[model samples]
Target: MQLIEQNYARMRETATRDLTAAYLDRAMAELRGELTPRKPEEKALTWYDPDQTVGFWARRMSLEAVAHRVDAELAAGEPVMPIPADLAVDGIDEILVTFLAFASRQWPEDFGDGLAGADGRAVSISVGTDRRLVRPAASGVEVSRDDSTAEASISGAPQDVLLWLWGRGDGAGLTFDGDPELVKRLRYLLKEATQ
Candidate 1:
């Protein structure tokens, strides 16, 4: 959080906003230089873990860039740009499986209650041709393709679903059917996972 605090302080400085831009420019260039030569599987340090891999951090940074781009657009009162389906799909998979499903060790305090709220309740998420079911499991919530018993569903374009998961959008563009409480619980869990 130290780096984030420094960045925020720089942005809030009363001297000149151009200084903030210059600092960000230098920081981005430095980050690119550091990461450009790293192999995907190479061990690396990240905010989330002391020793993850280059690929993990790289993927996360790429998604953060997309999310921040949307943030900037919305802040500027500009229409949100289109995200490539492949990137959106990959983002959805990474956030759900990598961060939420398989990584119980990183789960937040409310994970158990959240999982219980979703028990016997599966929400099918359809992104383009990709389909997944989110349901309770031994560890937190598990996302799978077993949609045969799905009692709820959220279907939308790839970008929409990805943005929804990131809390970038209100999901107005997405179609949600079945139990609202299940969806609310899913949103709560998402807030826990992302924030």
Candidate 2:
């Protein structure tokens, strides 16, 4: 995927506003024409997985765009628009289920080092008390979305939780209870997974 490498390199190289905007416009136009018509079940290529579905890429791209928009807003000292609760929830789910759950796929070498100490206890993250996302913080991360027990719980509003999970927002509106060790492990996993 030379284009992927090229795109990443281009992102690191600063360009004029016109050039950047033009490139983005062309990319978006191509995406609309090519990817928009693809079925959700259709096979797609991802940075981490080539055997992914169009639906996976679609959800991932949407969440990535939102995360980048937040980064732009923060970089420019501009106010970020409120993310809808549903989108925020979905973004949280995506990060937890795909990114953290598949941590080995991204950085297998450094991943285990980041997760040195693990007791195999789970952390239950709550999105307004309705969603119970339990993920065990271990060398091999896994998320179980069900009414499960965990050693720790982090509860917050959907958007706040999503932003905090992404390191875009402080955990001011969030509350943590139960085992601190579990929370620490999970937070470290989240940071490593997102990074």
Using lDDT, give the best candidate's number: 1
TM-scores across all candidates? 0.81, 0.80
Off by over 4 Å in 2: 1-16, 47-51, 105-108, 137-139
lDDT of 1: 0.72
- On residues 5-67, what C-alpha lDDT tens digit does candidate 1 reach at each position? 333333333224677667656766776776688887898776556348887777776777677
Q: lDDT of model 2 at residue 157?
A: 89
- Report each candidate's C-alpha RMSD, comma-separated, in the order given: 5.7, 5.8
| TM-score result, candidate 2 | 0.80
Q: Per-residue lDDT for 107-172 in model 2, tens only?
A: 655565646566467788888756655555345766776786777888898988899888888788
